[model samples]
Target: MLDDFMTRATLAGIGVAFAAAPLGSFVVWRRMAYFGDATAHAAILGVALALALELSIFAGAMAVALAMALTVSALSGRGYAMDTLLGVLAHSALAFGLVAVSFLSGIRIDLMAYLFGDILAVSRGDLGVIWSGAALVVGLIGWRWSRLLTSTLSPDMAHAAGINPRHEQLILTLALAITVAVAIKVVGVLLIAAMLIVPAAAARPLARTPEAMALIAAGIGAASALVGLRAAYVLDTPAGPSIVCVAATAFALTGLYSVARKAR
Candidate 1:
């Protein structure tokens, strides 16, 4: 299996899931799903820029995602609903990126690959990038765990405890950007936010606390990666979306169990 392309794909998916779990919990708790989606969508623009400039796709994605996150944060109270703002920015970026990609001459760009991911095509170097980026996300979250939770609970309470909620939000923004960058190879831009949100949602019914939710989400995410990859191999489907299908299946099952438990 070590010599197989599927092995690298599995490892890459697993790395992305573990990093996304905790970040996804915060996205769910803070109601930043739209923000996450907007940023992920903006990655298409990053891909265009990377190809144009001959730079690393990861670096380009991280830079663009960070810019998108910061732009959203700066526009938070500017007399517009967050959803409305994100919707405009997200779709606009995607449209422009697609147009830009169409203009690239002399290169056969497989737009579907970037949009939906080419996980089975991941190489050893890509695995190194995925795992390294995953480690960075985990370490950053662990360092700011308490502060972030406190801020999520209440900005006023965070202030009373000398924690700036905005700063914590920015920290999460940074982490989110990094996640999108690394995850581009594994799940691509279109499904990146799903990777962030689905496992956390699935884990919620089984968890009793914030910490438990994070750990459970990670386990759910890892399971989705493993199961989804095997299923994709067996069924001849797209690996990235298959992983999401597994996570969505988990979410459906957990939701049903929660409802049944409540009825009983």
Candidate 2:
């Protein structure tokens, strides 16, 4: 009946995979992997604020992630290089977050869990949060798929179509924030970027079109979540990192296959 914590954990993992995979494809297409990482790293700071103010961690994380994403979007047009800006923001947020977390007096915190996740510890309430957040991200992506793709292919093309490229970017930013909020429970901040990138990258060689890539990436992500969960159970390893490791391995194999096919 799969009606236990393990079931909840598995469901949470799958939900996150579903939401993150398609968005990951856009991230790969636009080369925004670093931006995703920066927003995720800001989650640590959110955790600190949440604990300090006695708020929900999810809410805090979401707020911080949105703020970070918006800030980047606003600044990206103002003479700042994208990679450099994200690098500065990502490391600074993480450093400040660690410092802030250290100041919470007499409270025992599982820092490792926030960094690497503890999926097995997820509860029914967490499952609700995960699925809800995932649904929002997926729905938003599906609703704006065409415009988003247009903007991604070329901002001028999007403008000519009367679609505001900036608006599409904001939609992606919103989706990224929600994904980060939900994913923290399943994969933690350290591995969220991996979840957002690896599956999409792995699916690249096998996919002939953008839509095909997104679908295949989602499938790969879901399979990795399930398979990695089982591997962690048997091997007694960290579930979040184990999943990322499996995804990386899959990416490498696909890359090799592509190379082999081209050589033939």
Choose the strongest candidate by lDDT: 1
User: lDDT for model 1, on a 0 to 1 scale?
Assistant: 0.94
Stretches off by above 4 angstroms in model 2 are: none
Instruction: Please report the TM-score between candidate 1 and the true structure.
Output: 0.98
lDDT of each candidate versus the true structure: 0.94, 0.93
Per-prediction CA RMSD (Å) = 0.9, 1.1
Query: Which lDDT value does model 2 have at 240?
Result: 96
Error of 1 at 242 (Å): 0.8
lDDT of 1 by residue, 116-224 (tens): 9999999998888899999999999999999999999999999999999999999999999999999998899999999999999999999999999999999999999
Per-prediction TM-score = 0.98, 0.97
Estimate the TM-score for candidate 2.
Answer: 0.97
Give the Å error, residue 187, model 1. 1.1
